[model samples]
Target: MKLVSVETPEKSVCKMTFSASAEELETASNAVYERTRASYTIKGFKKGEADRAQIEADRGEHTFWYDAINDLMDKDVPALYDAALAEHGFVPVDAPVYDLVSVKKDEGFVATATVALQPELNLTKTTGFTTECVTPEVTDKEIDSVLERRRNAAAELVPHKGPAVKGNIVHIDYEGLLEGKPFQGGTAQNQTLQLGSGRMIPGFEEGILGHKAGEEFDIFVTFPARYHAKDLAGKPVIFKIKLIDVCVRQIPALNSDFAKKVANVDTLDELRAQVKQQLHDGKHASALNRAKDQILTQLADAAEGDLPSTLVESTYQLQMQQIQQQLQMQRLSLDRYLSQIHETRESFTAKVRTSAEKTARVRMALLQIAQQENLVPTEEEIDKQLAERAERTKKTLEEVKAQANVHAMRRNEGIRKAADWVIEHSTIEDK
Candidate 1:
């Protein structure tokens, strides 16, 4: 192989032209013929035994030319690109794009490979950024909220004979009619629904408010125009409700018995302490994450680099796929989610483009920092991470290995180490 010229026509993009020897071209052609000879037949030879010349004559001179050139390029271009990249001393962010210029039997082949390299940065300052870290505080309200949730979970429902209110479970038999005709899925017998839970239509819960048990009354409500049911959208429905029972939750007293039953703590004070500590730990973790994010953002903002479009697009698509997976887990469709967020596909992509570019830039900066600080993650670190991940996810080591992108994981560890280095080197103020 021979390198004709290497050019940097754009920031982060490297273009190289190279030529292969005729001998190498011939070898590649032979390899391609051997790989595909089973599908060819010649008059004087068996299917797989047909020689290259015979197949070419039977087909055309240009038949194997493209495949042969591709085979040679595929085998050689990446190495050639890597050598050029090494000479230039720049890391690539994306795979090289190859364009075959010419291919001939005796003249060999010429091709061009273009690649996107990590951009150079002129970081004003990687460190010495003054920032305040909030000391995570567990508020009394937060503790009360947790206690309320636990109390609600432990509560029992008892029959009540008063007007239905919020937090009360109402048992009712109802038949809904649209345009004076019964609609499908609009009738339920003795269904229990929590009032003011917003599980039903907007007005359904509100209409049931102040209604006592054993009352037969009509509740009028209109479905929203964006309702999932097309036929029922924006339609008025009258539900003839026969309230059978109203039940209110009986919460357990916040005593030692309650503490023992709820969280295995022997005393209420101990339970409160445990809850407060849990909340504090959670808040501290969240606050630390936010602080890290702020630091990264400041670093990224100060760091100057040309982002490769290919890497940006890849990051954007990966983010979108994650969003799709999350929506699927929530039993929602992407289209429905977009509608709820008041965004279109193009608009959402446009919005993601900005963050994607920033992410790519931040990743490159982190990698650069890792390299400068010699903060590469060791094999033992990776193994420990994988093991911990497998244990936490309840998956086998092999399963975790199969699902993980080794390159990304390594880079992640490197980034983590880089962040740690920055945190250690920089001064922090507690707020």
Candidate 2:
């Protein structure tokens, strides 16, 4: 394979004309024929005894060329691409899309490929930008909140004969009617609800308050104007409610025994200390994240380059896929989530594109810095990371090493080192 011509059709876009040698094409064609000859029965020749000329005459000269070209593409294009990358010094941001230009029986094939390339960055500022990250402090209130949650989790529910109150679970049967007629999705049996939980529409749970067990009553509620159901939006409805029973949570006492039972700590003091440390660690991580974001934003702002639309779109797609996976894990639909968040598709898309562009710019700046510094992970560093990965994943070091893509690892580590360098060189002010 050979690169005949290279052209930059647009910024961050490379168009290259390349070809497979005639000899290589002929060899591939012959191999294809040899593999399928036993199945081919020419007009005058028996199976497996047909010559290339005979087969070409029987079929077409270009009959086997397509598969041969595809085989060469699979076996040879990648090596050619790598060579072009080295010789032309163009970093590809996406896979090259190839188009066959022309092909002849003995003259091999000519092809053109277009690829999106990484923008050459000239960052005006690389260091000394100030980053603000506040050191987080833990307080007794936060610790108490954690303890309260633990108590809530350990609470037991007891039947209450009195009126339903906030934090009490009420079991009831309800049938809603619009203008004295039964409506769709307006009936439920043996349903349990918590008053003041806000799980139901406005005025529904509020009416349950002060209602005693065994009482049968009706509550009127007007659906919000923005309700998802168009027919029910802003409409007043009456729900016949039958109060079965009310249950109240009996919380345990906050003591050393409680601490030991809830958290495995010997005493309340020890539990508080543990909670405080956990909170402190979380705050520290949050602070560091803020610092990283600030530093990257500043670096990206200082960079001047053309961001490939393909790269940004790819990143956006990856981000969306990750969100979809997370939503699937939570058994939620993306459209429903967007509705709950009060976001429209167009607005959300615009926001995501902005974020993706910023991310692309930041990554490009970091990669350029890494290249400029000739940054690469050391063998010891690589081994240490591999060991850590093995430990975390419960795999053997040999298995982890076998699965590791060393080149990719080196590239990613180099980019990370560049990020660390930027952070280290920056002026970080802690509040």
Candidate 3:
């Protein structure tokens, strides 16, 4: 196979014309004849024993030529395309559209393929940006919030005759009926639920509030539009609930005994100090994340280049697939999710495309920076990163290495190194 010519008549597109030798076409035609001879029975010859010439004479010359061309496309186009791509130093962003220009018997074939090329980037600026980094300080209220959670976890539930209130556990016998009929997995006896918690559907929990113990009543609720159950989604249902008991949660006082019960610390002061330090560490991590986002956003904003639509669409598709998978895990469909978001498919895709384009632009800028600064990761660095990933994923090093796309990972690490370089060189004022 040979690339006869290459042209870039359109933006981000490359068209390559290819030609093949007569010997290759003849070989392909003969192979197709041999494979399909059993299905044809020609006079004076047994089945599967007919010659290519005989079959061509019996059928039209174009009969085997079609199969031959298809076989060539299947067996040879990929390698030919790769060679053509290498000669032009272009990376395709999607599948090429192939057009057969001519196919003559024993004269080989002529074909052209057009493909979207990956955009080449020219980054104007990646460093020298000044930004404020605000590391959040642990507040007394935040520490108190953590202590309250601990208190709730250690609280005791005592039976009460009073009305159900927020933070109180209410035991009930209930049956959820859809259209006046009890549905599957919608009935429970002696079910304990906390008021104001979002464990039940929207109106169910709120309706339980203010209702006294031993009260038998019915509450109506409409399932969410994107509810996991397809049958009950967006449907109104009545829950006949008999309150069995109301258990008020009694939290212990914040003293030495409570501190010892909640944590290993012997005193309340020590526990408070520990909680403050933990909150500080968490806030510091979040601050670093915000700083990274700021740096990347600044870098992307500084970039000046047109992102390839093919790449952007591909990225959008990948993100959509991830969201779809997440929704499937929750027993919801992507269509229902879109309905809940009040968006049509086109609008949602458009929104995703915008985000994808921005992401692609940032990636391209960082990649160019990586190339300019020689920020390529070494084999040792790659191996170490893979090892760490393997440990975190609880997989063997070989398994992780086998499953990993090494080239993509290398590029990602290089981009990250470039980002780190910029962060190190830039001025970061603490605010």
Best TM-score among the predictions, by candidate number? 2
**Which is the winner by lDDT between candidate 2 and candidate 3?**
2
User: Candidate 3: worst 10 consecutive residues by lDDT?
Assistant: 305-314
Write down the TM-score of every candidate.
Answer: 0.54, 0.57, 0.55
User: What number of clashing residue pairs does each candidate have, in the order they appear?
Assistant: 0, 0, 0
Error of 1 at 323 (Å): 2.5
Off by over 4 Å in 1: 1-7, 15-81, 94-114, 135-145, 148-254, 343-347, 377-412
The RMSD of every model to the true structure, in order and in angstroms, is 10.3, 11.3, 10.0
The residue-by-residue lDDT of candidate 2 on 208-275, one tens digit each, is 99999899999989999999999999999999999988999889999998989978999989989999
Candidate 3: tens digits of C-alpha lDDT, residues 365-400: 777788789997988999999999999999999999
Clashing pairs in 2: none
| Deviation in Å, model 2, residue 80 alpha carbon | 1.3
lDDT to native, each model: 0.83, 0.87, 0.83
The regions of model 3 sitting more than 4 angstroms off are 1-82, 91-118, 135-141, 156-251, 322-351, 379-403
RMSD of model 2 against the true structure? 11.3
